[model samples]
Target: MVIILIRTVKYNLSKLRDLYLHTTCLATLANMAPHVHRLSAYASQRLVSLFYMLSRKYNKLTEQMDDKVGKGGSVEHDSLAKDMSAELHIYADFLRIVLEILNAILTYALPRNPEVVYAIMHRQEVFQPFKNHPRFSELIENIYMVLDFFNSRMDAQTQNGEWSVEKVLQFIISNCRSWRGEGMKMFNQLHFSYEQESHPEEFFTPYIWRLTLSHCGLSFDHNAVNLFTVDLPAEQLDNAGEEHDEPRQNGR
Candidate 1:
């Protein structure tokens, strides 16, 4: 009877191990299934493809804007504006599909990968590829309005003189930087162009500032003197001299 009991115990242990192994295999497959399915089922839909085409057109518009502005010509502005408006309508349709994708991902896929969802949520340029599209003008305008409001509040706190051009430019750069992550590739692309442009930094500095002011119901004085000078103070000059002297001493 003791021998019989030992044999039964060994058989049960074998079954338990088999069961655990099977369960593990199933769990791994379950984890991998979604990725496999997404890859296999992926196909570019009409709406998405249309957006891609429009994005290229919008890029050309941006180039045109730069060219026209550089040449000091207004003739192309109206044509560019019209094209941008038409592209915006197409972009709106694309946005609807994107929204649906976001909703589905949030409702279904987010439980498994919350990090991706969070990244998408915080990204601003998820919609930025459409920025040059006329459809995105309203959204861009809304963003400008919000920034304008913030600038106004800052102006009030600093009595209109507290914020320097550098400060405002820094704020814009910071806002743009916060968009770095998945789903914000469009914004990243736009930023790349902005950085690559040969336009004078001073031109953009005041242009952005004036844009914010105009958005906030304030007319910027185009002739308003820049109180901030690029020149360093006398102390900084002295420090530079000392640094130069130290380098010479080291050479000696």
Candidate 2:
């Protein structure tokens, strides 16, 4: 059952990776010049939905491991690592999928003006979903930031302050690209054991806050369900046994 669950999550990740790379998400919510406002709402909604899916799956896997040991029974190092190994690797890839989606949307789909954000915010359909913005805090915070930028532009003549959207957006873009690169690097380095030659923690040093706030990116490692436990699965042991049993190619 656990293996099946793992494979199902793996399949979803595979599809998400393809979709992220191709930028084919939200097909029905296609990019029409006049519908930029509507598209932004849809994109925001999509981001929240994806987060729910991935986090729920991760929590489910963690719960499954917890279930196996008779209600937190003897969750020792080896048992925890065994169950969580596949999930940690998958979590890295899933996070990369999310970052890629974010980069694509922010790069190509942000509203060109403040009125578009108003259009989105004021729309009857969007109003209800966005009304409870705090519920989708992470995604909505980003929407609010971008919308605030556009709103300031709209009210610029009346305001006395100066700000550069270009610089801020550039800061955001650089962080997205850097974080995406780090996510991919982490995916490539899939070993989750604490004792690996280089600890997985080496890949996850968070960005210092001296830069723009938007660079915080997804705080998955810190906030979400983590694969911090340790266990070796029976399959891994079986594979090790087979490897030991196999004859050398040159009988050496």
TM-score of each: 0.23, 0.29
Clashing pairs in 2: 77-230, 78-231, 80-230, 80-231, 81-230, 81-231, 82-231, 82-232
Global lDDT of each model? 0.41, 0.42
Please, what are the lDDT tens digits per residue for candidate 1 over residues 64-183? 656766777665467865665565444444343333333333333433433332233234344466446554554344333333434454455544456554565444334433332233
Top TM-score model: 2
**Root mean square deviation (Cα) for candidate 2:** 19.8
Per-residue lDDT of model 2, residues 36-71, tens digit only:
332433344444455445656655676676676656
Which pairs clash in the backbone of model 1? 88-134, 88-135
Per model, how many backbone clashes are there? Answer: 2, 8
Query: What's the TM for model 1?
Result: 0.23
Candidate 1 segments whose C-alpha is farther than 4 A from its true place: 1-40, 44-54, 75-81, 92-100, 111-252
